[model samples]
Target chain A: MWERNPVIFLLLATAVIMVGTIVTMVLPFAYVNTERDAIASVVPYSALELAGRDVYIKEGCNNCHTQTVRPLVAEVIRYGDYSKSGEFVHDRPHLWGSRRTGPDLARIGGNYPDQWHYDHMREPAAMAPGTNMPPYDFLDNRDVDPELTRRKMEVLGFPYSDEEIQALAGKTDMDAMVAYLQKLGSDIPWREQQRVTLVGELVNPFAGDPAAIVEGRELYERNCAACHGSGLSGGFAADLTALNYPEEIFFRIIHDGIQPLRMPGFATLGNERLWKIVSYMDSEQVAP
Target chain B: MERPAYNYDIVKHFVHWSILWGAVSVLVGVVISFQLVMPQLNFGEYLSYGRLRPVHTNAGIFGFAVGGFFALFYYMVQRLCRVPIWSNGLARFQLWLFNIVIVLSAVTLLLGFSQSKEYHEMEWPIDILITVLWVAFTINILMTIFKRREAQMYISLWFMMAALIGVAVLFVVNGLSVPVTLFKSYSAFAGTNDANVQWWYGHNAVAMVLTVPPLAVFYYFLPKSTGVPIYSHRLGIVAFWSLIFMYLWTGAHHLLWTPIPDWVQTLAMAFSIMLIAPSWGSVINGYLSMNGQWHQMRDNYLVKFFILAITFYGLQTLQGPLQAVRSFSGFIHYTEWVPGHVHMGTMGWITLLICGAFYYLAPRLYGRELYSIPLANLHFWLVLMGQLIYSVSMWIAGVVQASMWHSLNDDGSLTYTFMESVLAMYPYWWIRGLGGVVYLLGIGVFVYNIAMTARGAQASPGAAAQA
Candidate 1:
């Protein structure tokens, strides 16, 4: 009867279940805490960013978008630096989600400007067409509740001053969300961004071709004209016609966008076409 | 002597309410599955996929699955022990508390109050409520088992005991939090530790809630419907003991290739492979139990449900360990493949077992024959087709998505943009959506059959006793 007794049976069962729990979970608790540190650049989320994180949690963006980049070749290329454990030290309930209906947001920090994230959140399709992400347009209308943000910071042990919390008073959740997105992987340097330079012996295959220059003008109009202006005049960016650098230097500059100026490199357009664009640039008379 | 009357009215309420929750689960599920395909369907804060996904899971697992388990356990315990349920008043109290907790969970979740733990998502207040409700249930079951008229406990009782204790330990340990506000709390652990603990709780929640409970119901009800004892009680004991021991270690399999400790991942991987043994032990036991009862499979609709349910359990268990391998986890961990794997457990195994248990209990509870076996067969076929299409489509989608994400152009650049991958999934998502609709239709048939059965039921003298 004792062998079949339900009380004894359950006691033994509970004990059996605990052995694994203790080994896998509890034993690790002995050392896992004191051995880790936050990334050198990781500070607690700023007031607005913390508030944005709350909105991210509230809206369940983690449901579709993961924040971790695994250490794989293509993954590192697609999303910047692979995720590190130290990078998430300040994360409370880590937004390292389990699904990816959307792309990983781990290193999305500097991938785009704040305006881009704002527009994307407002209407995802406008920025990246055919995306399945629902428009979070309502976030732009919703104010960040400072009381809850303060409370949340206190709970997560993120230090903040009253002034810092107050700065977020009238900001919209959309602003907060963008702040959060931009701050994501800023703690670590991302070497995998398209922000690379072409260094080596360079030969422009299209340097002397007048036909290439004509085609480059058309390509430039479609791709670069929006920011760099038509007719080699400046709009949001530098006046290209005033530049007097060698054609190879021009290729390097275009291959590596002026990072501080926010010009994007057209690396995906490949070497042949960018050289053509350079040919058009060299053919143009200086706008003196 | 005639058997003493058990508190069957409580069983009736639990079964009926769980079915209601199950319907909500299916309805929300269909909506969210389509939301993956159609972004326009996500209505702002409340009805969107994020908030409602938890609502769907909470309702389905805790609301529907757990509720059905309660109903079946209550029914089976009384008969297996050869005694009446202990404390009818406590059982009644538990029934109300269960429904209240579920309602609070659904409301609070829709309002965006969550712990953000996958299965254990309800806020602190609701968590406390759930704890109290579970305790009330556990004590009552324990007390009943303590005073059994039968000297030797059945294999089903052992399973029920494990589930009761296992859930209590897992829930309270993982649910530990520090409350910041009324609706918010932080996980007691942080960063990597938090990830480790969450998946430990997350995956084991499946083991304790989904696996063990259904096995209890299955072990008891399989023989009851088929009119044969399980092939080997000793085999059941070995399988039961090994399964409970191994399941807790395997939770870290979900954390493979992640930031959790290397040894922990390796341990989890090893134990996960070993788990296929005990899981199959139960599967083989079920198959062998049907030795001479093969003829019943043809004539008895209930037998078909049990056999199919066990078959899916076998398939799910096999697929789970295979996915846990580091190489395989690399491919499918975050893809639609994981969900496809999970639905096989939920939709194929657990739901089928719950439906079978409900069907078996309905005639006995309501004191009438089932409305129609043909409709039951129709319901079965629809759900089967629906689940196959849903899982298979997602599996293909996961493979395609994995390949696209891994593909490289000649320049060593990614071949497809992430948008291109999402766009490619559109057709499969449509098919998955249709599968959900068909599954929901099958459940609609089930609800109709049960409702009609109860409508014409001339309240049995045994069932008429007031709680």
Candidate 2:
């Protein structure tokens, strides 16, 4: 029967493929509940963030950095918690890259300040030495098409207001990309608690030392200036002078990085250096 | 009986273009391999690693492998079916259209207009062109097969048919998307579903394009070169059916440790392990066919390629399933080991087989003896040594990476930062780059040999006609 009839053979062969595909690929979709209640915290990208996502796709970032954190202890520790199916419910054409030429970016949201991303994109070697990532400085000058981004969101059936689209009009592709990156894996309940935790009462050891303050100022210029503005005014990160938190809280936050936020631990920089950075911050601000 | 006047024009055209594209892909691959170690090599916006990596893959898979398939399929179908191509005009059109689609793919990807899906990077318009191109070729082949004078369909014909249907279904299904702009589209499937579907298409693209098509070519050309029929036709038929059944289920093996459901991962792993039986069925068939012809391995250059290719296929199939296991995947999932595994199949098995096929076809098409057997032997050794050096260095690097990543201090703090791991890979990366240079040199030798062969044919018309 298989020997003579080509049509029968073709039909049977095709049927086998369809059955395999249907069972694996197609059937899984039917089981996934698209309703909001099926998963918690699966929100669509905001108008600005949606635009940033467009920039992300346009730049082909997924070719290097993967966006899916696997369910392994090593991955969970290296990245944050293992990714949940619910976390990516809003992701269309998920960027779970098969190759990892660089680290996974699944939980990169709020992991660094916007300025750090900007600097890193412009010149990655400045931040992480020996990185093979190419500079995307061209994105800095290219303005995003807000209207087109909004239209695309509408086509995808995401709810966005006209006001939101108008707000994104002046934004650059770099701004959108940064915005999109800052939104990734940022909605977990535990991450919110980590951000809200305030360090308890403790004294700064280096507060009165003039020499330490001078060193601290230099360290802040090299490291903190990218996220905090050059003058310590607000930019991608929070304004340092505006926050009147105790010196100890500042020390703890700097020592043990803030989870789900862009604040990586400066523990590698040594406790003495961190104290100096805190001292620099304390001296720069006038008492409220 | 006079053999029906077979059309050699399309075959010759595809061979010429496929070799050109093959060289381009290998050169680009070498560049990207170096870019991993030397960030300075990333020239500017357009030539960045992110943009050029897809170009390397698309050109290698579509331009080189698929392009070679077109030449081989057209050549084999005519002889097997005992008829001329169903339409000379359609074949001619497809030849040009194939080149156009590939060029547009490279340009659009470099411009950063991509779907960002691996292996399916081209945006909506290019997707349409590819679909159209596949349909045209499919109709031509199927129609020719239906009108054949041959009484029975050969195993190679079955593989050709499977590839036609398999690729079409996989391509279209994975390509279902909502067009957001002229060069942008969003996949219809969201999140986990999207991942499952993409890899389903992704891994099978390897299966259909790289695995099945090459198997078809191997089954056809191996016997023709060795002057022996395949040891068991029944085994070939069984292997074909089993491969078609098992390959589709194994795509999620790529998604093993990810957020995909555990059952799906297990299913994929099981099927992947099961895949080895059929993969070896063909391997065994090839080996048995060469039982008494082992001496030819020393004499015939084509035999060296065929034997080594099947041997790599055997090793690839075994290693592939082993990697799919959850415990093993956890260790090497994102490491350099995976690339090492992949290159053995691609560089060792598929490329060698395709090159061997070209050597066989060149003389027949051009009506001339090869320019140099010594050059072909040199080409084989260079590529073999190059591929080994490439895969081996990567394997050692991957092990070091995986162990370092999983290491912890007594207090459970992570032992190595990600950058430390990156730093460690520099030596391996340099070695891998050197391996690429050697392989590229091999390709250079190959092209020069083929060009000289064709030129030699053109130089003397009487000698060519007599042969």
Q: Model 1: what TM-score?
A: 0.91
The best candidate by DockQ is 1
Query: Candidate 1: where is the Cα deviation over 4 Å?
Result: A1-3, A36-38, A190-288, B458-467
lDDT accuracy of residue B216 in candidate 1: 92
What tens-digit string does per-residue lDDT give for candidate 2 at B26-50?
Answer: 9999999998888888877789888
The docking category that best describes candidate 1 is medium
Q: For residue B210, what is the lDDT in candidate 2?
A: 93
**Could you give candidate 1's fraction of true interface contacts?**
0.63
* Model 2 lDDT, residue B411, Cα: 34
**Model 1: per-residue Cα lDDT at residue A124:** 81
- Collision pairs in model 2: A52-A176, A110-A261, A110-A262, A111-A262, A112-A262
TM-score of chain A of each: 0.76, 0.73
